[model samples]
Target chain A: MLRRKQFWFAIMAILPTFAIFGWVRLFPIIETLRLSMHEWNLLSKNKPFVGFQNFIELFSDNQFMDALTNTAVIAFGAMAVTIPMSMVLAAIIYHRTRSRFSGFYETAVFIPHVVSLVPAAMAWKWIFDAKLGPLNAIIMGLGGDALPWLFDPVLSVICIIFLVSWQTLGYGVLIYLVGFRNLPKSVFEAAQLDGANGFQSFLYMSVPLLKPITLYVSVVTLISGFNVYAQAYVLASDTQGAPGRQVRVLVLDMLENSFQNFRVGYAAAEAVILLSIVLLLTMIQFGLLRGKGGR
Target chain B: MSAKARARRTNFLLDVTLFVICILLLTPLILLIANGFKTPQEMLVWPPTLFPKDPTLENFHKVFTETPLLQWMLNSFLFALLSTVAIVATSALAGYIVGKFPFRAINIIFILFLATAIIPFEVYMIPLYFQVKALGLLNSVGGLLVGYLVMSFGIFLIRQNVIASIPDELLEAARIDGAGELWIFWYVVLPLLRGPLAALAVLAFFQAWTAFAWPIIVMTRKKSFTIEVGLANFQSAYTVDLSLLSAASAAVMVPSVLAFVLLRRNFVEGIAASGMKE
Candidate 1:
């Protein structure tokens, strides 16, 4: 390799990468931002500039609000439970379990991590099925009523969260388990020497030590949770289905408006907002975590 | 002596209980695997049985015969194969650049790419679909590959692994030794990165292979349909063949499962190696 040519070679190595990123990631995002300003539907004769009206229309839409609220409830509601439990389970496997059972347990739990959203949703939907599902069977087995799972909007959302949590718990365990392993053994040992036994050792030493893992889990889970579409789509049918697509998440709505309805400009505006939220939340998450010696 | 014996027995019992919990975690799939061989009628027939009596091969045959499951499987392999290749190559290059040769914009780009991990594919599908359509990339397998690669968490993940594992001194020594950048990357860095890169490859393959949302939005027809997308189409009033659908699902799932198990060690090591972003 020529010495001066080496620099070009280094640059050349990354050129294909930049080309792909620019075309697929960069261009779409920029195009979406630009498309938000123009009303160009597939059926329309003359394309015209719409300025900020798409944004205005999106915020005012009732369906948009419903989707937003549903999305938040699922994301936050699921994470609130999962993060704490993951910490506790991770702690048990890390601190309490001395034998190789932890490895067995970790792998078993993480198997669901490898399973995708679509099949898992189908299975969970079966579990939550009203007529023939096992959930109802178990409920009835316990002398309870068989309830409408998907039909009831609230129950459906909760069930979806359950599915999300199940699908994600393995990842949470894997990541947190690693974090637990990385924790300073001396800190816990010192706490033990201080007679901080059992619960105290966990409370005083383990929890604080796993703060980094907790923060990481929160941001990652939040991101994954926000992007949840496959479960909703798989369970609810392609775009939006009968019973008014009650479980329609924001992404679904964005899909319907932009692609199905040919509201490209409006959909582009929604995309921009959605991306902005994801980006902003990510920054905020980093900021919040980074505050107390954030990683 | 009696008290000590009791304590030992209790400890043994507790270990068994822990094993039971592990079994419960895997029970769903164990149930599915047992039932994947059953007729739809037999599967529905419940005293809620665990094992199918006949354990027929009919469902598997229905899977292959009625559905384009084999085709979808081929597409899935292609999708996973091509995307993994792209991610490993691009990410290794990009990671090498940002890892060595510190630039002023590196930190900002690092954060930008990291932030991309947050903006899920759903957010991009509509815009991306139109982008594909406008660029004349509709119903194209290669186009899907590009869309998948753009979400470069694999790069960011690999870079983190590279940074954590490889020392800057190695690069410095190589530079002094007149080993060029390409040579350094190919021989030194890539070898060290094998662990994380393999792990990320498994992950990247899974994500692309199981991808449903973008495939739904971008690929308008069956020609470019991936396994997951095609498997989903059965339930969409397109077909009511539940048995065939499940068969297709198992087909999509088996390769991923195998990849996961085969690469299991690396996956754990990779995630463990990176620690966490928090």
Candidate 2:
């Protein structure tokens, strides 16, 4: 009786979490997979199975291809810029500061991260505003033409990438700063004894030592890159990636299809593809990290 | 120059450079606040000044008097607080059971929870919306709350904390003293979980507070809008009112930043811990 009662209590404790997860996460995932193979306008009574027809159409669709390419570019682009920038900043802060004031710098950089993306997007929008924004204001004042920051497709993609990098830079810096602080002091002393200079020490010692952290940060940055929606949405002003759909990422594309175009089945198919990409990237990262650990 | 003097000069240069970088990082945020105080005519100048020539509180006053800003703030607060409380309660109970109790099925349950972390919101956005609609929670705070309640990371965080910090021997001693499992958890394990719980609360609050996309979808009614959704809507409606927009954005961002300031250490440590573990 005692053992049975304890077992029942444990089950009860786990049930709420299980129920929520089952209803919200697991069921949606399964339904998305099932819906991916069918055609439904979300208004009809029937969702007829199309048997990979949606997948075949998605592969051939030009917009889906553009979204996929844009997502890859932003994901890899943001990580490429953010990781190095954060490493350098983290190195400077770690090496330079000797007082409690270092906390102020960390907090300052991190303020943008905690702030909502909508306001941050709006702030960036203001900065990049054609006539009134500071960037173009400076350009025009210097006897140059005012550039189209968000009007040009390429420039708009760059702007979106810049916004993401700015928001996430602080997070990367904090993580790398922790990595720097936890490094053994003896390793630096040994490098000095071997007559290695600062740049050489950083190149040879610090970079290699921080590889795991770099990988971790890259994985997170990559996943967030694939999940980019609100920044693009706000920056593009909800025109379904204005200026010829140059900045349309997967999520934005999926959302536009489901809500605007009402292509529920096709959008569900897109969602499945995105999920696979995220899962594959994550698995590859884990495999690489584990492989490194094995040696 | 002496070596020590050269080193001191180098350190000074480094500090100046870092300070300059910090100022550069802070320029956009400062501009946001500065523009909020400027008059409409002043905002249209050739080269925008970093400082408003005539600083006034009229824009903030207008935002308060004109829009439903306070209602949105109230909605945001209620959602964040309710979600944070629910997450803490659920995570603590589930984490304790899975971490402390030696149940045979614990690993499978724990894995099931962690699996949700791998899937981003985009993957299930459509179906989840349908589910919310089916449950008749569309445009309701209850819908939003239900969506946020299953934080996989929070459960995992608390579980790791409990297993690592709270020893099994402690629970065993409580049991030997004629305490029930509920009492042991309530009086013993719960107290030891204060640190992780606080960290989880801050994380949960930020997630709920800054949430954008789903809130935009589910809260279709204007009266049910959260601060983020409200700000987005406001921006779309009044594109030219830079002052009012800036004031509203500042109003929305201050609370989360303030919460972060008060709990800065926990926030940093929690992020660092999670980052390193992965």
Candidate 3:
């Protein structure tokens, strides 16, 4: 009787959380899947089921294609920059744990992670400004031409990639540092005994040993990179328009389709694509981590 | 040189390199703060000064007097504080039960909760917007919070913390001593769950505080905007007012930056733990 009562109590306890989770998160996801197949505007009473018509239209749509391509490039680009840089930085920090400035170093690196995104992006936008920004000023001082950071088509995407990597680098470092701490000391000691140097041990052992951490960090960085919106939005959002290119990204495209353009179903299709990419990456991450652990 | 001296010299070189890297890493942030105090005229000066040529608080003054910044900050605070409370409460209650209980379906429920973390907010945010709108919550603070009230990550983190920290024997003893389940939970478990709960609360608050995308969609009216959304809108309105923009961004950033610095441990541990478990 007591056990049964406790079980009921447990159910009641979790009921609200499950309900909120299902309604707020799970239900919307399922509805987005269903909505992807149908055509509906915000005002329409009926959503006409159009099968894969929206998906087919999206493939042909220049804007959607551009957005998809930009988002992919940004995601992969950020992941590439973030993983190697953060790992090396984390290794540096991890080894210097005895230093008093270690805490300062960690906090300094991690501040960007916690700093509000819009402002951070804004700050970077200022830094990347072509004429008046310091970045170009320094480049010119170094005798390089002051390349347009936010205006040029290619440079604009690179700017976004830089911004995305900047925000994610701190997070990747923090996680990698944790992975470093958790790594066994004996392995490193053995490596030293075998006459392997610090860099070599790090190259041979730490890199491979930290595969799961790398996978986790890359997955996180890539997912957030794919979800890139506000960074691009804030960077190129100058209204008086002194040469800023509004780089089309997936979330921005979906928002435009949904709110600005009022193609709910079409946006839903884009959402589905974004969903598939994220879920696919997450599955791969879990699979890789599981494979490593199982071994 | 002696081997120890050589080692010391290398350590000093490494420290210098790390310092340079940290400065580079923090340059944008440094620029945000330094430029916040610059006059508009000074901002456009050639050889853009790192420290304001003549620092002034006029931009900050103008932001408060000229814009709905105070209202937006209030909105942001309400959203962050209320949502933090909601997430912590819901996550704790559910985490405790799911973490401690041995009910037949509990494992599946726990897995389901964890699984939701994999679904990026971008995937479901559209339908969530529609749902919020359908409920007549558009342009309201309540609508802004509907999406943030429960974080799947918090559920997982709190559950892990609970399982690791709280033993079953304490709860079983409380139950045997004729304590009601609710009372035992309130008295026994909550105190023990304080450390993780605090971490979850801080993380949730930071997430809500820095939230942009959802708030921008939900709170369209200037008066209804959170600080982040307001700051963005402020930028468009004052296109050339770079100083004012920097000041506004600085104001928005300071609290979060301060909080992170103060609660550095919780933030780091929370992020690290989340990364490890995932």
TM-score of each: 0.90, 0.96, 0.97
Instruction: Order the candidates by TM-score, highest first.
Output: 3, 2, 1
Candidate 2 has a DockQ of 0.65
Q: Which fraction of the native contacts appears in each prediction?
A: 0.43, 0.69, 0.80
Q: Write the per-residue lDDT of candidate 2 for residues A98-191, one digit (tens) a residue.
A: 8556878888888888889988887888899876889998888798999889877778788889999998999999999989998898999998
TM per candidate, chain B: 0.87, 0.96, 0.96
lDDT string, candidate 1, B41-69, tens digits: 86566445566677777778877886677
Sort by lDDT, top down from the best: 3, 2, 1
Error of 1 at A119 (Å): 2.0
Model 1: runs farther than 4 Å from truth? A1-6, A43-47, A96-98, A237-246, B1-17, B44-48, B103-117, B161-178, B237-244, B272-275
- Candidate 3 chain B: worst-modelled 10 consecutive residues by lDDT: B231-240
Sorting all predicted structures by DockQ, with the top scorer first, yields: 3, 2, 1
Point out the higher-scoring one by TM-score: 1 or 3. Answer: 3
Largest DockQ belongs to which candidate?
3
Give the per-residue lDDT digits (tens) of candidate 3, residues B1-278: 99689878878888888999999999898899899999989999988999997899898998889888888999999999999999999988988888888787777888888887888898889899989999999988889889999988888887888889888898888888999999988999899988888888889999999888899888888789899888877766666788888998998888879889999987787787887674
* Tens-place lDDT digits, model 2, residues B226-260: 99898887865665687788888887777778878
Q: Score chain B of candidate 2 by TM-score.
A: 0.96
